[model samples]
Target: MKLASYADGSRDGHLVVVSRDLTQAHYATGIATRLQQVLDDWGFLAPQLEDLAVQLNHGKLRHAFAFEPEKCVAPLPRAYGWAVVDVEGSVRREAGQFQGPHQPLRAPAACEPALAVITGDLAAASDAAAALDALRLLTLAVDWRLDGDLIATHCAPLAVTPDELGEAWGGGRLQARLVALHNGAKLDPRDVAAVPGDALARLARLRALRAGQLAGVSLGALELPLAPGDSLRLDLKSADGQHSLFGAIDLDLAPPPALP
Candidate 1:
């Protein structure tokens, strides 16, 4: 099941179910209005959303519409927390700094690709296996840093349920390449060396990692310089190089404001 958030002026946008190929979508209107609501009640709400996804994918829904990435926000526009472990094994948890689609920002210094997981409520000390079981959705991420500090993190337009990856998701890791495109050219294909387990295991030590909280493991090393007016597209391709798993993080950074 693939899910997204359509911009609705509110902090949490309207929930949407996207097709596997990511070309179409159906509003999860009656099922749920926000992604966080579904995450809060996954056991009851997720299956319904899954059914809608099936209908949307098969063109059985009459109200399905074109999936527009430009009109998207972060999957969880207001997540409980955003915890990320960088290549240096440093873990940082902060209020979510997320963007989607064409949202522009100040010029970013460097862009690094990553894979993120949205996990359900997890108790402290939960091992990697347990952490894996709590995983809800998976998506691609781009870490845009300035002066070695995380300036922004762009999440792919759509997030898919872990099972959506099929064989690509195994051993608590997503066997995929975090592909970053600069101006339509491949800048770096970050074969995520920091697997989900690496981040999950580190996060497990925390007192509690609640639902609606996102965690990620960045690509081990490498940063692609992104200049002002640069366009960056971040997505995940199957390890075997078959297809795109998540939608994409298509961002364009605006040039810095002129001096007064």
Candidate 2:
């Protein structure tokens, strides 16, 4: 069970509750029986939970709580459908992958580490707004870093309708661009396009390209780990808002730190 507490920085009235399972974020209904079992086992406090409501909004469980904070215990809604659950369930050291209720994580296959931005359709209606919102959500970049570098900075548009986007952007086209900034110079954009039908095949090619480049780096691979403060900047946009995630890995090798 995962747990967190929040207060107005006060020692009293702090709310503490255990998050019983990962599936609760996806299909709280599917885990309904199990959830009851877990809560029951926790003793008297478990039964005290009433006004429990379920969330269908999407994203993490927080959405569930947000929908009706007072009336019930809401299960996390199935929001933008992006999840990066750790294998050990410890929420530490794991790869990132985009998952929708009906879509399998294997659709994109997790190999290189990644950061995924999930914006709903209203987001696409305002590309500039979506881009800025995506940036704000991406402060969690360190959680998605791999190989001492971030494999890809990406996005997933949700909620907003296609017609809404078309009305705003004047076309059915949306895009996210991530530039590699080195020594104050921005490198040309790398390809991370998400297309239909052969998207899987094309993504395979992109991964191959990354591997080949990483192998050939003359400075040797950046085996160093990223410090907590390290991060990469990414830009993203979408037209339909209902689309696959966008991502790109860094192939450039950073110069070694200066010697004393």
Candidate 3:
């Protein structure tokens, strides 16, 4: 079931169950008022939320109203931890071939794109599930600063989840894409590189996750620079155009302080 947390004049906001088509919603306050609370007790709350979803779809719930994405924040605004697995070059490495320069590559590789754990509180993560049962799901929109330069900034919305996100990596590669926009102008499209066969299996091998921790797998490898007044928008769509995930974040040298 699709779920979202909306701004309700509170830090955690109000949790709601969104319809499949993204048109309508029903307040899930009866089950949980915050998204993190529901995820913390997913075993017990999922079933209850599922039942409510059925009722809402059948026109049986009261106060069901139109749902807008703009009014919603990241599903989990403040998670315990957010880590990204870089699957972009997994395929090429497995075949004993390097896609970049043939020169002797240095150690501590320049752009190996290893698993990166984001620091700070500016990363916004969103979900894109295939069958809704997948444990490893979600995409990310991160605010970044240029290396060694604190003033230059950029926001990258990368790693959209493909429809195969829930499927096992059975000697097959999943296709994905990332489309980025800067100040309303479209940038070049980045085709997601193939994920190696063993990546997913390794991820599954890890111990079960705790309540508030989140793991993300990014699909595309496009990077662009942004200016102070510029805005960035990213959209990741499934190969069949059925499922899509989106994120938007602004860039600034230093954001203004929050109001008291």
Task: Give all TM-scores, in the order shown.
Answer: 0.92, 0.24, 0.61
Say which prediction, candidate 1 or candidate 2, comes out ahead on TM-score. Answer: 1
10 residues in a row with least lDDT, candidate 1: 188-197
TM-score of 1: 0.92
Summarize candidate 3's per-residue lDDT along 1-260 as a digit string, tens digits.
Answer: 66666777776557887765557888898899976676666678867987887787787877999976666655555666544445542221111111111111112111112211111111122122211233422443332223522221111222222332433122334454555566678777655544332333333343333455544344433455443444555554444434454333322222334689
Candidate 2 C-alpha lDDT tens digits along 29-115: 323332223222333332332212122222334534421111111111122223332322211222333221111111111123223
Residue 176 displacement in candidate 3 (angstroms): 3.4
Q: Whole-model Cα lDDT per candidate?
A: 0.80, 0.25, 0.45
- Candidate topping TM-score: 1
* Model 3 score (lDDT): 0.45
lDDT of 1 by residue, 68-184 (tens): 988999888677888878878888776776877567857766766667888899989888888888889888776677777878777878888878888788766677777767788
Cα distance off (Å), candidate 3, residue 256:
10
- Ordered by lDDT, highest first, the candidates read 1, 3, 2
